[model samples]
Target: MTERTDRTVLLRGGNVYSPADPFATAMLVEGAHIAWVGSDGAAEAYAATADEVVDLNGALVTPAFVDAHAHATSAGLALTGLDLTGCPSLADALDRIAGAARTADGVLIGHGWDETGWPEGRPPTLAELDTAAGGAAAYLSRTDVHSALATTALRTLADGLAAQPGFDPDGPLSQDAHHAVRRAALAHLTAAQRRAAQQATLARAAELGIGALHECAGPAISSEEDLTELLALAAEGTGPEVFGYWGELGAVDTALRLGAVGAGGDLFADGALGSHTACLHAPYEDAGHTGAAYLTAAQIADHVAACTEAGLQAGFHAIGDAAVDAVVEGVRAAADRVGLPAVRALRHRVEHAEALDEESIAAFAELGLTASVQPAFDAAWGGPDGMYVQRLGAKRAAALNPYAALLRAGVPLAFGSDAPVTPLDPWGTVRAAAFHRTPEHRISVRAAFTAHTRGGWRALGRDADGVLVPGAVASYAVWAVEELVVQAPDSRVAGWSTDPRSGTPGLPDLTPGNPLPACLRTVVRGRTVHLA
Candidate 1:
C-alpha cells in the first residue's frame, strides 16, 4: 500500500489555483513538495528535468479538499448498508427495512430517514418498525443522527435501556437511550465488515478530490477500537489522511494513545434541531419544552482547560443557540484560567456550529476557535418552509448558520458535510454555502472553497498544507471544467469579468445551475490516488 513519491512531475497547460502565482498555468512537484508554480513558458525549464510530465489539456488544478468533520464508519455503513436518505414516506422506508431484513445476517442497521416531509408527519412507531423488520433486531437512525427508531428486538440487546433518558417505548430513541442502542447495533458488525466500511468511505473521499478527513469519534458515537483501526488503515498510504478526534471529558491520554489530534469532536454540548434535541433558550414551536442540554458552561470550561493544558484541541457539537452560548462561555472561562494566549494557540474547534449570534461569533474569534460548520444543514433544512422554521419559527430560523456574519466577525470557518447526516459532496457543499437560501447569509464561492481546503488545515494547526505553493505538500486535484472565473459575493469586488490582469486565480464557474467540475485525477503528497 506504500505509494512512491520520489519522482519529479511537471504539470503544464492548465489553470493552477496557487496564491504563489495567481496567473500560473503550470506547476512542478518534486517528490512530496510543490517546487514551482508559474506560467507555461516557465514550466519548460522543469519539463526537461522532471521524471514525468503531464499535459493538462485545458483543465483546472487546485488544492484537494479536506473534510474538517466526518464519521468514517457511519458514512461507510450508509454507503454499503440500507440507506433511507430520500425515502418518500414512512411506508416506503419500512418497505426498504423489510427488504433488508430478509437478507441481513445480523442487526439490520440503516440510517438517513427523515419523517418531517412524510405525509404521515411522523417517524415509524416501535410497532411499525418491528413489523417492518418482521420482529428481527433493527436500528434506523434519523437523518440528523440525534435520534433513532429501534425495534424491541434491538432494545433487548441493551439491558435496562428503557430507563435511560430520551427513551420511548413507542417512539424514536434519543440521548442516552439512542447511544446505548447504537452501540449495541454497531457491535453486531464483524471486524472484516467494519474494515470494509471504512475503506469504502475512504475510497469515495479520494474519488471526490478529498485529500484528508477529520474523524469525529467518541465512546458514545464510536468505539476506541473503531478509531484505532481506521487510523491504522489510513497510515498504510492507500487513502486520504485521517485525523482522529476523541470526544470525551478528560480523555487526553486516551486521545494521544489513539493517535488523535484532539480530545474533542461530537463532544456534545447539545444535540441537533431535526430531532428537537438541540438546546434552545426557548421552547420549540412544535414541542412544548426547550431542547436538551448535555453539558453546562462549567463542564465545558473544565474540558477546555484540561485539553489546553494537555496541548490537545477541544471541540464540541453545539448546534443550538443555547449550546453555542455554553461553548462560548466555557471557552472564555478556560482562557481566563489557562491564560488566553495558550488556549488560543491550540486553535480548538466547535463541530456543527450551526447556531450563532453576534456575541458567540465575537467570542469565537477572540478565543481562536474554529467553527467546523456544515453548510449542507442550511441547504437541507433552512428556508421559509424547512425544518428550522418548523422547530424555531421564522425569525429564529433565519438566524441559523449565518456564515456571512461569522466571517465578518472574524470567526474562522472549516467546512464539512458531517456525513451520514449529509453526504460528502465537496463542490456541492461550497455551492450550498455560496447560494444559501437566506441571501444575506451567503458567502463567496472562493471563501467557501477555502474553508473546505486550507481552512481545514489551519484548523488542525497545519498552517502550510492544503494549498499549492512552493514548499507546500503536493496535495491537489486535476479537474475537467467548462470554464474558470473569479467569483465574489459582490460583482463590483470581482469586477464581474474574467480578466487575467486581476491577478486572482479562477475557480470553476459555480453559478447555481452550472455543472460542477469533474475530477480527472487526485494526488496526495505527490502520489496519485485516483484517476478518471
Candidate 2:
C-alpha cells in the first residue's frame, strides 16, 4: 500500500484490538501501514521517533467498520432532507412532510417510511402526498426503497410513468414506477446540491468510525454521474475509502470504465418483502400473489457468466426464497459453463439474501458467494409479530435472515446498514445479529463484529486490509466505551474477560439497551479523518 502521508504516529495506553497480541495496549502507525502492536512498554521504543504521539487514556482501538452495502446519495438526501424513519402514524408523516414542504425549496425528497407498522397500515395516497407537498412535487420512498409515494406533480414529470409496471395513480409506486419517479425527483438536484449531499454522507461515515463503504449504484438506482462523483470525492483521501458496485446486466465494460469494483449490487432479482414483492415461492399471507421476479434463472446465469469471464464480481439483491433459489441456480449454471474454479475465483456476491435455505446457504459456500447482509433489518422488522411475520406468516418469517445457519454452512457474511433504509449504526448492527429476534439465528457478537469488519474486506477480495497487524493497512477507530466483554459463540460460556489469560480481545459491551461506544477518533490509511 502507498503511504497517504509521510508521518508515523504512536497510539499507546489504550486497548488495542488485535489477534496477534490479544492483550496489546498500544499500536504504531508508520505512514499507511501498522508498524507494531504490543504492550505500552514496547511502544516507548517508537514514541520518541514518532512524529505525533497520542495517549489513548484507556479507550479501545479497533479496526474501523466497513459498510458492505449503501446508497450514498440517497442516504445523504435523507440525512439533509425529510426523514420519516420513526414517524409513528401516516398522519404524522404527512404533517412532517407538510412542515418540511413549507421550508423545502427544490423537490421534496424523503425516505424511510414504512406503513407496515403504522396504524393506518398503508402509505399515503397520492392526493394526501400532493396536499402534504402543497401541490409541489414530492417523492417519499418506503423504508425498503422498493416502493414510494410520488405526488401527481412528480409523477407527471416522469415521462411514460403510467405505463411502467407498478404504476398507480392513487397509492405508492412500486418497481419501475418508483424508480422512474425517484430518478425524476433526483434530477431536480443541482450539481452543487448533489456534491454537498455526497460530501455530507462521507463526512457522517467518517464521524461514525467507518473507514470504508461500498456504494451500490446502478442505472435504475442512481445515475452514473452520482457514482462517479462519489468515487472522485473518496479518492481525495480526506474521508473513508469508497468502492462502487454498478448493477447492470451485460455492462461489464461500463462498470470497468466507471471504476466500479463489480457489475453487481442492487441488481434486483425481486423487490422487497415490505412491499409484498419479494418473489416468494408461496403467496404472501397479506398479499395473495407470490411477489414479483425481475430476472429469470437463465438471465442470472448469463450475467454471472459474463461477469466471471470478465473477472468482475457479480451480485444480486435477492430477498426471497424464490429469488435466492434463482441466484443459486443461475450462479451454479454459470459455474458449469465457466468452470467451477473460474466462477469460484471471482467470489461473487448476493446483497440482502434475507430469505435463504439450507440449499442456498450450501450453494453460496460452495460457489464462494458473499452474503452482504443488513442485520438491522431484523432489528426493525423481524420477530413473531413484526412486519415479516405479517407478510410471510410466522413460519416463513421465522426463517428469514438465518445468519447462524449460514455461518454454520460456511457461507461468507458481510454485514451492512443499507442506510436510509436502516440507519448507519455499526455497533447496533452487530448487537442486532447477536440478539436476533429468532434465538436460533443469533451469532456471537465477536463473529458479528468480524463480519462487519474483516468480512467486508474479504468480500472485496482484500484479504489482509481490515485487521490490525504489522504491515496491515492503518484503518481503525478509537472508541470511548463503558466496558469491554469477550462474548463467546456458546451462550453458556463466560463473557466477561478481566484476565489477560483469556486469549481473545474484548469488544464493547453490546448488551441491548446499553449505549454503544462513542467514536473518539477515526483514522484511514494513517490519515486522521475524524476526531471528537
Candidate 3:
C-alpha cells in the first residue's frame, strides 16, 4: 500500500511541457514530486483534498532550468570582482581595476576582459597591470575565462610552467600560464570567504529561475576549493542542489569516492573561442594561430580508459571544431581499445562543443557523445563582429553554436550558462537558444528547453533531474513567469522570477523608452526558494 502524505497541491491553468510529454498540460504536485499531470478536470480530485491550489491562468510552464556547465564559486566571486564586462575602453577597465585596488588588501583578482571591444589591442601589459594594482598582486582573467592575464609580480612565483609546452618567455600566458595563476589565486581564498560567495551566487541563481546547476568548476587541480565549498554547502543544506563536474581525469577516482556518479568530469581536448586556445582544425581568422589543445587524442583516450576501467562516466571541455574533433577521436580510440560495455549510454560529455563541424557532430552520434553547451554565450556574444566572427570570420562564425544542426545530425544536446562567464539564469539561456542570431542554427524552444531539463539529466547520465513527471525525482521549480510574482530586484528572488512576468505579445524591444521588467518567482524542490 502506498503511504498517502496528504500533502497535495494543484497547479491549474499553467501550460506545462513535461519535457517528455507530447504537449502541454496541467500537473498536480504531490509533496516533493508530481503525483499526476493531465487535464484541468483530471486534477480536480486531488484539488478537492489539496493543501493548496495555485491558479497559473494560462502561463507558460516547464521544468526548472539546469545549467550543465557553470563555475559556481567563480560566479559568486564575480559578485565582488572588478567587473569589466561592459567597459567602453581599456582606460575604463584600468580605472575599475584601480578603484578595486583602493579597497582590497590581498591579492587582487578580477575577470571579464575582451580585447576585441577595446580600441587598442589588449592594453599595455604587465607594467600597466602592476600600475593598476598599486602594490597588491592582481590577475585578470579573459572574458572566456580560459586564459589569464598576469602581472609580472604574479608571474614571478610560477614554477610549474617553466618548461611547459605552451609557455612563452615574455608573452602573456594564454593557456597554461593563466591556468597556473588561477589555481594559486583560488587556493588563496579562505573557506569562509568561498562559502559566503557561493551562497550569494546561489541566492542570485534562484532569483534567475535556476534550480539546479552542474558546476564545471574547472579541472580538479583548479576546482578543489570550489568543490569543497560546494559539497560543504550542499551538506549544510544552505542552497540549491549542486552537481559538481571536476574537469581533470585524474580527479575521477576522487569524485567517484566522493559519490560522483556517471557522466563525471574528464578532459576532452581543448579551450574556448574568446581566447585562441580552442583547438581548431584551422588557424584563427585574424590571429592566424591554430587553437591550442589540452589533452592529445591519446591522452583523452587513456583518460576514458581509466573511467571505463573504474566503472565511471566522463566528460570534458571542447570548444573549437578541432577540439570537438579531438573528443570524437578520443572517444573512438577509447571504444576501439577498451572494447564496449564499459562506455555505452554512460553519456560521456563534451562541454561547449561550440564550433563542431558537420562531420564532428556525426561522430558525436556515432560515439553517443553528450554536448553540454552554454546558450547565453552566443546570445550575449553572438552579434556581428562577435568573438567567433572575429576569430573565425563571417562564414565560419555563422557555423558556431550549431545547435539545430547538431540535433538534426543526431548529437544529444544539453544547455549550460558557464556562470561567471554568463550569469546562471536558465530562462535567459533558454531564451538565447530559442533566438540564436543565425537562423539556420536556431533550435526550437522545446528542443532548447528539453536540453535545459532532461538533457541535463542525460549529461549526468541519469533520467532524473531536468524533468517534471510522475515517478521522476521530487525536484522542480515554480517561476513567477507562471505564478505572476513580482519583484523589483532580480538578485533577491530565489526559485522565482527576477522581475514581473508581464504578458507581452512578443520579445521586448531594446530601443529607447522601453525597458523590460525582470520579474519572476523561482522555487525548487517544492520550496519557495525565491520570490520576485
Provide the clashing-pair count of each candidate structure. Answer: 0, 0, 21
Query: lDDT of each prediction vs. the true structure?
Result: 0.92, 0.91, 0.69
Model 3 / residue 492 / CA error / Å: 37
Q: Name model 3 segments beyond 4 Å from true.
A: 1-7, 19-26, 39-44, 160-171, 218-221, 262-268, 480-519
Model 1 C-alpha lDDT per residue in residues 207-289, reported as the tens digit of each score: 99999999999999999999999999998887899999999988889999999999999899999999999999999999998
Stretches of model 2 off by over 4 angstroms after superposition: 1-4, 492-495
Query: In candidate 2, what are the lDDT values of residues 317-422, reduced to their tens digit?
Result: 9999999999999999999999999998888999999998888889999999999999999999998789999999999999999999998988889999988789
Write down the RMSD of candidate 2 (Cα, Å). Answer: 1.6
lDDT of 3 at 229: 64
Give model 1's clash tally. 0
- Candidate 3 Cα lDDT to native: 0.69
